[model samples]
Target: MFSPKLLLISAIAVALVGSILAISSLYANAQNDEEKAVNSRGMGYYQTTGDVLDPAGSSGSASTGIEPMKYLRTFNYGRVSTLPNGTTLREFTMIADDRQTMEISPGVHYNVWTFNGTIPGPTIRATEGDLIRIHLINNGTHPHSMHFHGIHRAEMDGVFETINPGGQFIYEFYAEPYGLHLYHCHVQPLEEHISHGLYGVYIVDPKTPRPDADEMVMMMNGYDTDSDGENNFYTVNGVPFYYMHHPIEIEKGRLVRVYLVNILEFDQINNFHLHGNLYHLYRTGTDMEPDDYTDMVTMSQGERAILEFTYQYPGQYMFHAHKTEFAEKGWTGMFLVKE
Candidate 1:
């Protein structure tokens, strides 16, 4: 019933519509492929899964037996001094008088001698309402004091009036803001003391409960030395090359969360890179928000990052400073992915 001219026009329109749909489908497919590539290369958002080791014994309980948020403790044995040149220097022996070097990194195996002979001395993981008691002992000839980075009490702040060599002071105060934090000596020559390794990480996890898995804390510190050289050292839980203490051990498809704190005394920036997985940075210092998610993050001095990622591949991956130079200079750590 239709004429040849009308039929030809209708056919042409159909062909044009079909061609448009085909082009759109191809474009969508290409986009999907790009996303897959990025994720497989550990460059995008991807969920990780794995088994968590029970910190307890065969009975499956942590050995420490200390309740999750009960009590926390630490010791600070440092020294402070006023040099003849009027450069007030606060120095602390990383090595304790006992001669046992604290484990700074897990890979180093042998403990590196510290100013007080202890890597990060000791950790104080407490809750918001718990009172923190730190006994500062001046075993060295110089006088020293302990100051909490973000803590609130003025009396217990460890100012000059409250610190002295051979004199002990107990800092008693309740924890307020919760998140990754730092504690160090606030004497005149702070750069000298921190360079000598007289600082540590302090964490106050939110009162809320978290999933069952290993809890790891890392502190990135830098030192400027005149004799040897200037370098940055990544210490896990307070020991340089102590990555072994808090190695990320996981089975295929396990969720892991890492709390990274930067206690660097200088203005150097740090980039945290996870080699084989994508992570979500859920919190920063005392600020927690949904927008903090990211695969890579940067932290300046006095900042903190709380990131969670999963392991899918079965191999050993590394988490280190993306600065390249820092990683090459031994400012790196490891993460093991097991099947």
Candidate 2:
């Protein structure tokens, strides 16, 4: 009952409908694929697809369990407090987010934005399973936050929650599985924030404290004089040639514990070397046992170590980065051992 021309038109219409259906299905598939990609890469507060609770796994951008807070006992110091609940409570506060000129080396000054007006904020210490609270006030012309190497709720992790100038923030978390860690301003242009000295060391001691010893803290850092993405002057504990000029005094035959942290930016690697001794090294405080016995250890940026040694004899011993240029640039130090 249909003419030939009508049959041709009908076939054409059917083909058009099929093409439309095919295109619609393809488009839907593409949307699903994009969603999957986003989920895999993580979105928003989610930094990784891996288990966030795993304190031993590596999460994206964060050290997670591999690399590495806070609470209401209002405090301005960096020490651990024990709670009746078997949890240790640690508290800290930092101020001064504005820029100021600092003496990087002897007669060499650079403008730095500091926490508490120091190049390396404050050294914080605590025991494993301790709860920590940090209060931060921003007095500079920028927004910033404190990001630590610990496990915590995503919202409490301190990223994306920035405190603007004249503002403040409270960060709290538990210190898990002891280790030497770091805290820094995680704001954008991280290089600028960290390089300007808004960083510090965090030490989480083991439940059974390592044998009593003479404990000390040393941190390595660098200053970029020209803002050229390369460090010009290297320092330990904020000043260049400080230790070389005023060597650390120690008692011979006494166990010495050193919490060493490296916060140098724009450098490939920095290191610590002792001229006259070897040390039992804990490459982070995670292990109950020493990781190795060595004379020198190399650390990348933000890495830390716990070293134990006993000077067998009383004398002057040298310690510094093995990188000769860094040493020449004022990273050298000495330990004066006495009976």
Candidate 3:
């Protein structure tokens, strides 16, 4: 007379418990036949498994270890000043390096190429019509270059600006068409460079400037662990499920502006969704007008937009990609609106 559904669930639970115990006991029965730690061969490099071949946990060659929370509000404003002709000049420096390990998830790691030693690099911000000067140093064994997504002269284009290892280049251009843009290594084998993590957000504020608000940058990206064409894990700000563990704290009833960018390689499109609110979507942030008032937005690789919203009540809300496969894999987060 017991309910059939209840009995089925009970049986499944018991079977699951038994399987877990069996798997645990297998390790206990495992005996070491032969094991040896291979050392030497004069390889002074890091691997994707978070191992520094030179010295164990050496601070000199250690990874940046940038946590998601710390990188959330980080922005690079550069040295700002006014030119004699009444224009803003922003000077910035970036170093390109390779053979750095970063954990994309718990116990999961990858060897990442970096700009200033972070996956998504630094958020470079400037005002419209400003003279943006970037000094790029190539410290990696491979040549690298920065191709910015904004209006600039042909000579300043990155394709021909590739810098050999131990070299440097100066790229100066005017920030035109105020919007949320992006930059990445444009060396040959472009996809390989970008997939290895040499990209960042570029923000050029409007001349009039947008309203005051809590602004944040979210760059949608992914990590391919197996050298396959498909991505194994996706992330926001370079860490999977980071916001879910440390929900973004925001004040209730405050305007929140998000400069969202989609730089996910191996995927045609990516998206964002909110659980309990809608936002005004500014496609590419080129104009002040909004193109849509919705809770979700889909963007292609290199596509970016600006979204503004306000949380009414204080609580925790989930935000993630509308694509179920992505959310289940890693493209998910939470926002905590505190009273």
| Model number with the top lDDT | 3
Whole-model Cα lDDT of every candidate shown, in order: 0.55, 0.76, 0.86
Residue pairs that clash (backbone atoms under 3 angstroms), model 2: 55-65, 69-132, 69-173, 70-132, 70-133, 70-172, 70-173, 71-132, 71-133
The top-ranked prediction according to TM-score is 3
Off by over 4 Å in 3: 1-64
Q: Report the C-alpha lDDT of model 3 over 1-339, residue by residue, as the tens digit.
A: 699999999999999999999999989845654443434336443223333332211221233265667667778889999999998899999999987887666666788999999888999999899999999999999999999999999978888978999999999999988999999999978888998899999999998989999999999998888988998888888877677767899999999999999999898499999989999999999989999999999999999999999999999999999998787677888899999
| Global lDDT of model 1 | 0.55
How big is the RMSD of model 1?
19.6
Model 3 compared with the native: what TM-score? Answer: 0.81
Model 1 ranges off by over 4 Å:
1-116, 225-229, 232-247, 285-290
Ranking by lDDT: 3, 2, 1
Predict model 3's lDDT versus the native: 0.86
RMSD of each candidate relative to the true structure: 19.6, 20.5, 14.2
Candidate 1 lDDT by residue in tens digits, 1-339: 699988999999999999999988887743332221113223344432433322111212222211112111242322434457653333333222222333223222332323344444355566554455555665554556677866677887877543445566666665667776777766667665565556666776566745664556666775443324455454334333234323456667777767677766554577788786777776554655543656577878667777777776787787777877766544556667788
Clash totals, every prediction: 33, 9, 0
Q: Model 2 over residues 140-245: C-alpha lDDT tens digits?
A: 9999888887677887777889889999988888876688888899998989888888887777777787898887778788889889998887877776666665
Residue 174 of model 3 has an lDDT of 95
TM-scores for all predictions: 0.62, 0.75, 0.81
